[model samples]
Target: MVDTVYLIKKPAEFPIADLISDNDVLILIQDAVLRQPSISNWYACKEDVIARGIKIPDNKLLDYEDILNLIEKSNKVVVW
Candidate 1:
């Protein structure tokens, strides 16, 4: 069975990043891909970023495969 803990949907003007831990992983997709948090633990979906016409050299862009790898590697994943 899948074992993801928390799922946050549409966090606007909410500093939800504050709840992130050093071990937590943040996967940004959809409309959430718009804002750029000044943190090293965030990753935006490559396809979504491209679809949004955003070119971000600073943030790491992850494909579906890479996203699976990250989830497999993490003990607990919190999607915000």
Candidate 2:
């Protein structure tokens, strides 16, 4: 399980590097998928990516169920 899960819903640079650790997870949803960051342990919402016509890699995309599973498995969750 991950220590923390970050749900990014918008496009903005908020110095997340300082808050994130190696075991933490980052999920890009909504408009945030448009700005793909070259960070490890990062995932994008499949539905959002399709809706936005974003071409994220298959391995980097997560369905709603996967997202729920990640949130449930995480120790903490932060939305941005």
Give the top-scoring candidate (lDDT): 2
lDDT of each: 0.65, 0.89
| C-alpha RMSD for every candidate | 4.1, 1.1
For model 2, state the Cα shift of residue 9 in Å.
Answer: 0.6
Clash totals, every prediction: 0, 0
RMSD versus native structure for model 1: 4.1
Weakest 10 consecutive residues of candidate 2 by summed lDDT: 11-20
User: For candidate 1, lDDT tens digit of each residue in 1-80?
Assistant: 23442333343532465676776666777777787667677677788889989886744788878778877876776654
For residue 25, what is the lDDT in candidate 1? 62
Candidate 2, residues 15-78: lDDT per residue as tens digits?
Answer: 3587788999999999999998767789999999999987989999999999999999999999
lDDT of 1: 0.65
| Candidate 2 CA-lDDT value | 0.89
lDDT (Cα, 0-100) at 70 in candidate 2: 96
TM-score of each: 0.72, 0.93
Residue 30 CA displacement from its true place in model 1, Å: 0.8
